[model samples]
Target: MGFLDGIRASKSQSNNKSKPPNNHFVAKDIVFNVDYLEKRFSDCSDIVFRKIKSNHKTNKDTIVLVFTDGLVEGMSINDGIIKQINLYSQIYNSKKINIDLLQNLLLVNEINRSNNFDEIIENILSGNTALFLEGSDEALILNTRGWESRAVEESSVESVIRGSKDAFVENIRTNTALIRRKLKDPNLKVKDLKVGSRSNTSIAVVYIGDITNQQLLNYVVNKLEEIEIDGIFDSGYIEQLLEENTYSLFPQMQVTERPDKVCANLLEGRMAILVDGSPDALILPIGFIQLFQSPGDYYERLVFANFVRLIRFFGFIIATTFPAIYVAITTFHQEILPTDFVLDIAKSRVEVPFPPIIEVLLMEGTIELLREASDRLPIKIGQTIGIVGAIVIGDAAVRANIVSPTMVVVIAITVIGSYIFPHFSTSYTMRFIRIPMILMAATFGAFGIIITWTWLIYHLCSLNSFGFAYLSPFAPSNLVDMKDAAIRAPLFGLKTRPIPTPKGKKSRK
Candidate 1:
């Protein structure tokens, strides 16, 4: 009874948070006064301010509009707005006006009056203008947001050899347009959500209407609604927040810079999230096979794609476990190797003071250091670092017998395998997972390696990305989905979607 009571008390206390309760706040309650708003936002480096005054005899009101930096270009006191203000002034004075005047005075700009504080702030942040009337409590917000942004370039991460050259930009609207340009169906829906308490990043949830499962869409929405963070710097923040397991090292949400890749996921009935200020968009309910897939697979010939896929799959295994397997076989099961090969390996290690595991750790660590340093340096310097570091370090270490020449070959092959694994993010993940394999090898040799592998499989099986099983179309066995998983079948052979969630009303046509 006491344990249960304690648990209930803890839950109650957790529910009573210190943050502001979620509730409806009216316009008056939310908006700071125009002057206050300016003062508060003036210090912000990104805020832009504009002042527009009425030129009519009756109305002496000044419109103070604020927007994000560089979003609004030119503000003109045009005839339409001036005429509308003149009529409003006359009405305020209880003066008689011509009946035909209403049509000309009633402008399209009246949509601005419907703006509440939240809407005004939303518009302002999005690079739109928020207007403040001197006598009125409501502010007129205009949507004239535009700014200089980096032009769409070839995707840096998911570059295709033969497909589209255009990649997603930092602008959310432009990114949506890129996808919309490719997929021109009206069924493609984009739902907007404001994430991040401080950053207030604009995020768009996009999916095909008839194809996507409603239950899964609602689940994603509910998960996003549950987030209470102050800021979301990247798609990674939302990924971690919405994921089932916080402790898992494996990424549940897949991010891609390519619009085509996002379109491909949407066609498979998965949801895509586009965040403002980020070129990369998150694809939910991604399977392990999806991570291994390259956009190049869909662009090139089937035979070429299949060959590439096979190489990647082989590379995956070699990159992840080759070092561990080598260490295990050499240290504990030397009989597995040929007698001559064993003799050669033994002779190579004669001058080395460290054990096999230490030699591997030293070599792998140096390689990683060189790789990281090269990435940070300028492009020209980066090449220099790679060439000079690899050549000088390998020659010096092998000749000095700090590490065996055989060990050098194994490490070099492992590094090369990691680079060829299609997705750099997944390759990085595998690289991180390699350390544990090395540790396991050192602890209990072959048995430890097997145990580690089993644990990894169990964890992968347990993982669910946005309610879809991570190891889908493999662990449960879906024949139709398998056509594009391990091997790339011909385009005509793939006649169905990957089945991300439960079957909906729409199937592949």
Candidate 2:
């Protein structure tokens, strides 16, 4: 069956099941609201409901403050809210205590009225205090989110010697505040979105309202809204779901932990997706070259930055093609090598039992295994394992004649080159691309390597990230945008934003 047909069948099957009864009870009397909430939270041991009573001459009223224990600050509820209410009740005489009067009398900064029981529950669960009063039909939600979270620290992944030290934390509001701290423009917009049906994960889309393309904004929003999932644990999950090409090995979005990086992209007319509980944010409509750009590029001198960028590009080429080229040249095109080099290689391999392809595969697999092992182990032990494994294994292989020393050097260079990439996802993609190239080279020599390169370039050119060309400024050949592609030009030299931006809005000025 087709994709749409399958979806229809699933919908029909789901329709057959009885729909869940709506639990959205509106707050009316205090007794009914408290009883319903207590019943709903019967299993929750951390739920706290504090009752406060106020007596004025002939009238007596009760207020219940509901919040999740350990999720809220006790001082805020007691000193800031309850204490002030009690003081006001003793000093003033009132027969009716309305939400407006309570809000004005309270010392809290944030207060909103809501009658929906679902909203009240959600607020309480999200570290907010809900105040339900006797004889009142509305509940007030106070912002008391004081949950423990890691303090902002320098990002280990995207570290820069001269850049801002503060990185995004898991808290969504704190992430937004970091971005706002950098870009104080009124046009900076933060739109909240809730994804994941069961998790109800909070996601924020941050962009400069005036500069961001409306079409791109709409596209991102619609795509996010279309997502139907059980939960979203990280920004990575959202990245995968929102990417235009899921089957491609190349990443369609850029994931970053630095708020400065996100702000820079937003200024460039790009939009950022920040998911709650994820330090990393996803940047969209990103070109392939962007994967090589570092956050430090803008901090250093233009010449030095451009030089580093060129080195990264060189490393990318070497990482992806070195193994395949070495295999093809030594195995099939031996005549292309100098006589001395050829003799030396032959002498080295004389003691080896496996062919060029087999030697390459075996060494590559061993290196990959060691690399993965190191990554999975503890930090100190992982480093030790990688060093010891590489030195000991490479030396043992050479002594055993299972692989040549020269082959080991080539593979070493390939692995080291892959590490030069700024983005981990790009490095991973390079690793994946190398395997296919290696296989093709083993089968068809240098011609196979060329064929693989051609196919890779074609695939990259064909892909798009949110309608912007993936291999942009190269395949489409935008000379203006090329200034920042392989090598970045001076900051002042960049007069216009990247291509595919809203028409007439391309100029950065």
What tens-digit string does per-residue lDDT give for candidate 1 at 290-394?
777878888788888889889988887888899998899888989989999999999989999999999999999999899999999999999899989998999
Off by over 4 Å in 2: 1-23, 56-60, 93-96, 506-509
**TM-score versus the correct structure, for each prediction:** 0.85, 0.93
lDDT of each: 0.75, 0.85
Please give the lDDT score for candidate 2: 0.85
| Deviation from truth (RMSD, Å), model 1 | 11.1
> Residue 180: error of model 1 in Å?
0.2
Error of 1 at 147 (Å): 2.1
Output the TM-score of candidate 2.
0.93
Give Cα distance to truth, residue 169, candidate 1, Å. Answer: 1.5
- The lowest-lDDT stretch of 10 consecutive residues in candidate 2 is 14-23
Q: Residue 142, candidate 2: how far off, in angstroms?
A: 0.6
